[model samples]
Target: MILFFGTRPGKPETKKLFHSICPYCQQQGALTAFTVKNYFHIFWIKLFKISSHTTIECSHCKRGFYDNEFTEEMKNELSK
Candidate 1:
């Protein structure tokens, strides 16, 4: 029998935060936050989620940032 167990990244889910500012773009740009998760899979089927990260993107500039870049206040406001 062949055993198949490994970790893989799941599909990213994004939510837009309205009326946001982009420091890089220096404009009133729409901010979108997304979640990416790594999951344990067996036989190509995801068994369980191992780790997850939330990140933000600028709609106008199309830049991405790590979770640490944004404050908890920003996350709390935009994550919902």
Candidate 2:
């Protein structure tokens, strides 16, 4: 039996972080949040969502920040 089950990532939803500053570029309002959902797929068909990940990126410096690297302001804004 051939099993074609795997996980795939969904389209990332992005939102600009207002009043958020990027630590790498030191630029204000340059932070953007990206939320991506992973789903389990079988035979190229999506079955169920596995998990989701949130990442922050700096448009000025193009630096990526993970969950543990998020700043206080970033967390506050993302929560809303």
Candidate 3:
């Protein structure tokens, strides 16, 4: 019999971290806390969480910012 195992993306969770200006959309109160979690899968079902990350989102223009795009101040803001 053949076995199936691989990686899968879990349902992302988002929280209202705070309101801030979005650089992309240049809009007010467009910033939010976004999270992505990846997991190992077995038979196409997620088994366990393998990795996770947090990011910033702009609701106005519907843009996202990854870890690499975060500045030092941005990092600090998330920590709080």
Candidate 4:
């Protein structure tokens, strides 16, 4: 018998941060928050969610920041 199991990234969810500003671009409302869920799969079928992560990106400058690099204002707006 053979088994196929692995982890895969789920669909990405996006939200615009109205009150957040991009430090690099200095553009308000340009910050968009993206969240994705990682899932464990067995035989090409999703079994369970392993973890989730957040990423902040600037539409104007096309810069991306990880969760750990989030600023205070960015964190506040995302929490709400």
lDDT of each: 0.79, 0.93, 0.76, 0.94
Error of 3 at 15 (Å): 1.6
Candidate 1 yields a Cα-based lDDT of 0.79
Clashing pairs in 3: none
Candidate 2 deviation (Cα RMSD): 1.9
Q: Write the per-residue lDDT of candidate 4 for residues 29-66, one digit (tens) a residue.
A: 98899999999999989999999999999999999999
Clashes of each: 0, 0, 0, 0
The segments of candidate 1 whose C-alpha lies over 4 angstroms from its true place after superposition are 26-29
lDDT of 1 by residue, 1-80 (tens): 99998999999987777656766685564678888899999999999999998888888888877877885556667745
Candidates sorted on TM-score, descending: 4, 2, 1, 3
Cα lDDT tens digits for candidate 2, 1-80? 99899999989999999798898888999899999999999998999999999999888899999999998989999999
Error of 3 at 61 (Å): 4.4
True-structure RMSD for candidate 4: 1.5
Name every residue pair that clashes in candidate 2: none
Task: Output the worst ten-in-a-row residue range by lDDT, candidate 3.
Answer: 14-23
Better of 1 and 4 by TM-score: 4
Ranking by lDDT: 4, 2, 1, 3
lDDT of 3 by residue, 16-65 (tens): 64545566777766678777899998889888999998889877788888
- Worst 10 contiguous positions by lDDT, candidate 4: 18-27
Distance from true position, residue 70, model 1, in Å? 0.4
